[model samples]
Target: MDSPTNSQKTVSDDEEIDYSIKPELYDSDLDDKDEQWMAKKRDGRTSDAVLSCPACFTTVCYECQRHEQYVTQYRAVFVVNCEVDKDRVFQPNAIPSKVGKRTRDSEKQETGSADNERLNPVFCATCSTEIGVVDIEEIYHFFNVIPSEP
Candidate 1:
């Protein structure tokens, strides 16, 4: 019997493309000390601190230098209150819904994801500077700001 020609050979149905490369592991050691420090500074302020530029819908935390300077030089600081309320200081159109949704989903999939609350950084209305952020579960409270010395 003669061997099969190139065009006469039978092809197997179980052949599959191989894609067995192992995924690369991510290193989580990037320096986040600055962010941690900033968050800590913002969380250390008292609630009685006078809110500046209250009409502007943005949060102001004590961790920001501009807020600190305003408090130091003028004895009072002004910040845009970005909390969601009747006045709505933050622009609804400016919020990125898709990004926020994706982040929320990712957090849900990770371990130790019990904390469902989210916080977004607030921006100054006039200069567009980041003054602080609002914690969703914290009763619309602002965290982090440069406070004037008492």
Candidate 2:
């Protein structure tokens, strides 16, 4: 009888060989079909809401996604449901007459024009879509009042 070489492994009738090393060799079509099925499964939903700039009418959500420095002046107010507390919310402080005057004067002094006003987000005047949140201090401030947990 000839002795087996190191490259040749002896297999008995009861031995099981693992063919999983070349998984792609077995199911190329099945893998492609699975990818197609996943792509189809992922295409059924639309966004319930969208954010746009009040002045420019451009989609500002992408800009808001990036972290930016913002000054939270008392004039610019926003209403937001607290994610953690649930019950309490922050509403924009009413623009005080004195504060408004100061802001206007400051703008006039710095820019030589009184057009540097912070646009307050209200209901989209054109689309009538409710402004659900305002981005301030790089945080999303939700307007929906959250119910308190018992």
Best by lDDT: 1
Write the residue-wise lDDT of candidate 1 on 76-134 in tens digits.
23243333332334322453456444456565576334344354546455545544544
How many pairs of residues collide in each model?
17, 1
- Against the hidden true structure, what lDDT does model 2 obtain? 0.37
Off by over 4 Å in 1: 1-47, 51-115, 138-144
* RMSD to truth, every model: 21.5, 16.4
Off by over 4 Å in 2: 1-63, 66-93, 99-114, 118-127, 132-150
TM-score of model 1 relative to the true fold?
0.26
In candidate 2, what are the lDDT values of residues 19-92, reduced to their tens digit? 55675557768978975764464354222233353443533231112123422211112222111222323345
Error of 1 at 40 (Å): 31
> Which candidate comes out best when scored by TM-score?
1
| Global lDDT scores for all candidate models | 0.43, 0.37
Least lDDT summed over 10 consecutive residues: which range in candidate 2? 73-82
